[model samples]
Target: MNQVVASAPGKLYIAGEYAVVEPGHPAILVAVDQFLTVKVSHSETVGTIHSSHYSNIPLQWRRENGKMIVDERENPFHYLLAAIDYTERYVKECKKELSIYHLGVESELDSSSGLKYGLGSSAAVTVATVRALLKYYDLDITDDLVFKLSVLAHLSVKSNGSFGDIAAATYTGWLAYSSFDREWVREKLNTHSITALIELDWPAFMVEQLSPPEELKLLIGWTGSPASTTSLVDQVRAKREAKEENYQFFLQESKSCVEKMIRAFRDKDLSAIQKEIRQNRLLLKNMSESTRVPIETSALQTLCDFAEQYNGAAKSSGAGGGDCGIALFDRKASLLDLVSKWEEHDITLLPLQVYTRS
Candidate 1:
């Protein structure tokens, strides 16, 4: 039996959360060491998806009339199914076919106790599944193809997303990314099929490689609570649509702060990076207030305050009602002291680092 295995890393947003959804606004993201893995093996009769994280019972699926059908009751692998469907569509567009297979999907992106760490698990799983299926069929898969398929599959499931996580999973390192035009995507979705969307000239979505300074120390602390990113993003989007002026101001300020941080990264200016981190945190706080969305929870605020006392910078990494907050410090700063402070606040330190693709 032919088998193929592939994995993709989860992501953390360093800067530009709500604002990055706007077309052309840039956000910095880092792919973390944690990854979701997918294994594909040839199946003689039927397709099945097995995940230890979800259950012992394997979910059966089949492709009929060029569409995927799966048992939807208590199904937890919709993203995987969606990815496979999208990849199959792409392959069909290229005048090809994918063989029947049994897929095993799993992840190490969550806490030991099964709490989600707000690390782009769905995006990583989608990317990994797409890569595994393409490799299993001996199809040539480029990074651009992986990204587009992953985004298409994700959008089919959620309908609204920025896809920074998809970019991070595909690129597999630190990246400075500009948002693709959401309006353009919606229009294309209305008029085109998934295969046709892949062939279209995508709008100005840009991603650039970036590196943190050598003297910088990165730490992630889990707040033991999960935030509903979809709910938070939807609330903010509705508010922005209603009050354009306030959201526009937030976007401009966030863009400015992100630009400063990028410049600091290019110049290797630690002080400037620290300053921008603080400014970005404040901008998010103001945005939370204006949108009436709890982007930063009390626990995250306390985490930032503790980091500030040690002259380090900290903020909620993603949509930020709760989950994980990242802290940045100089090499000379005492990690022991900071960890102790976090422990006192009952926050758990997540031992994660940036992952680079080989």
Candidate 2:
């Protein structure tokens, strides 16, 4: 192959954050227009990796008996490296010869300052890298296989996240997701071959593409403060252990709310969808109060309040702390009024639209 390019969209959680960590719990997510793209080109002597997210200079690597050797100082591509390793391993098992290639990545998922907008850039990059490499090798690429490979590769780097972001990146649209049992996957990884593992049905994993009501419009607002999702999740986990009863109550309520929202989406009931969004926000607030995790920071609270003032339903997206908040409004609602209110509070309205994979 001369050069193959692949891209994956960033994701935002529509609802169900901490509660979705548990296996079989449901969450809503949407893939945004912002994307990370990877390009792979054939190489002869050495394979070079360049990333716009990193320094302008490229990192050079050579194969020594089928092993990649790179300078330690220029090794910021942990997720990319993992994706290459796993995909190459799968290729070897499928009786394909490995080849050297130059990999380059460029992303629009973050700010000019390289600050993340909590748009699941890591997941998008992993999916994009795998897709590009698979195409470069002239192997068949399917969304299901890409998702499975990305999950395996991502877990090898960071195992704390629920991997819902991976699903959104791979599927690329509005999604209703239930997390698979990671413990089961980890155990299976030790016992089964890569080919066998991808063929098997993962326990409790469910992903369904959703159709948003045509009358509803989704909006996103940035608080300008980046949040560590892993950190917030850890704090909530510690609190869950301490107050098991309250945590369980929150989980049950969240599952119920997400289910209703899913139904609302299917029925095209804009009213019910907005109602569930409000209920979901209050549930998250209660969880924050009980856990003391500060999921909804002051800036995020301001963003949500402004949406409510404009007759919309809003709440913090993902693990909160201070990233982005999402709101749902009727098509006829005055978006300018909401934007004006948000600007007064120094909240930036992001120009993001839902992206669906063709």
Candidate 3:
């Protein structure tokens, strides 16, 4: 067995969503500090998987009797590994003998339980894992390969992904991505401008890899627990499919909001960011009656209510309906006070920074 290492970035969704799947809409994202690390250690025939791909998948599986069978009937690892293989063209290009060397893989970073913030953690892992395998085999992989492989891996794994997080994390900065190209285009953004706006009077927040820049007064709140993002997404898709409604408005508004958010980043205008997210909430709500379907369980409503009281702004961060939400505030923000409230609601608070890693 050969030892090979691979890594991928965590993600933050700035804007552009379900709409981006179409041809023109652009999805915006910023890589977060967290990451996924895969260490592909080879063995003569030793192969076992340890993962948190989903809540129920067991820890171990194997290939035997000329078939890739698993101990668990429902483990998605085989599917996950298949996506990687497809993305990296592993089965297509590798010699049959080398292919038997199952990767003793590990997804070092799991999804954040604190909030169902729809960052591209899953896709990032896929990209990194495939990248590691390609590197291990001395194969030349391109950015396009990474991006496409990531999408395939993610959609295959979760069926309810938007690819925004993966694109942002993979590029390690603000990015403008389109599903059409199946690639992430990196854009170097000046975070100082955005941070400065967020700071104005109080201490400024720094954007860097997964580390909190400093103690500040930023508030985080949630309502509903994490739910199947796919469910809500499917709802939206179904509505569009029936022609009962049009997402054009949602698409246009989301694109517009993201465009504004990027400016806010450049301008460091907390107010603008806040306002944009608020608009995003309304649009998402309109897309589907998510607010009625136990939005309270997500604590999304509670957080927004809290933010409103403090003259701050809040909205779901990832795919809405569950998981996590993002809150933005100026001098009016207070994280400490919110912690007790969030704790009372049993919601975890994770303070995250924009990715500044090179």
Q: Pick by TM-score: which candidate is best?
A: 2
What would the per-residue lDDT of candidate 2 be over residues 140-247, giving only the tens digit for each residue? 998889999999998898667888999999998999999889989889999998889999999989999999989989999999999999899988988788889999
RMSD of 3: 10.0
Name the regions of candidate 1 deviating beyond 4 angstroms.
189-196, 199-201
Model 1 agreement with the true structure over 1-358: per-residue lDDT tens digits: 6688999999999898888887778888999999999999987668889987667889987777756678788588778778988888877777776567789988898888788999998889899999998888778988888998988887778746678989999997878987787678778978998667776777868888887899988888888898888888898888877778988999999999998898899888888988988899999999888878898888998888888898888888988999999888998887788789899988989889899898
Which regions of candidate 3 are displaced past 4 Å? Answer: 52-75, 87-102, 105-121, 140-142, 154-160, 181-224, 241-246, 290-298, 331-334
Candidates' lDDT values, in order? 0.86, 0.91, 0.56
Error of 1 at 138 (Å): 1.0
Candidate 1: worst-modelled 10 consecutive residues by lDDT? 91-100
TM-score of each: 0.95, 0.98, 0.72
Q: Which candidate number would show the highest lDDT if scored against the true structure? A: 2
Query: How many steric overlaps are in each model, in order?
Result: 0, 0, 25
Please give the lDDT score for candidate 1: 0.86
Cα RMSD of all models vs. native, in order, equals 1.7, 1.1, 10.0
* lDDT at 199, model 2: 92
Tens digit of per-residue lDDT, candidate 3, span 1-358 = 4678877766655455566665456555566566667766654554555555454333444556545555556565644565554543443334433334445444434444444345455676677777777776667766655555565566455455556665665657656665543232111112223222222321111122222213223444434355665676666666575543356666787778766766665666666667776777777666656223333234677766766676766666556566666666665355567667777876667665566545
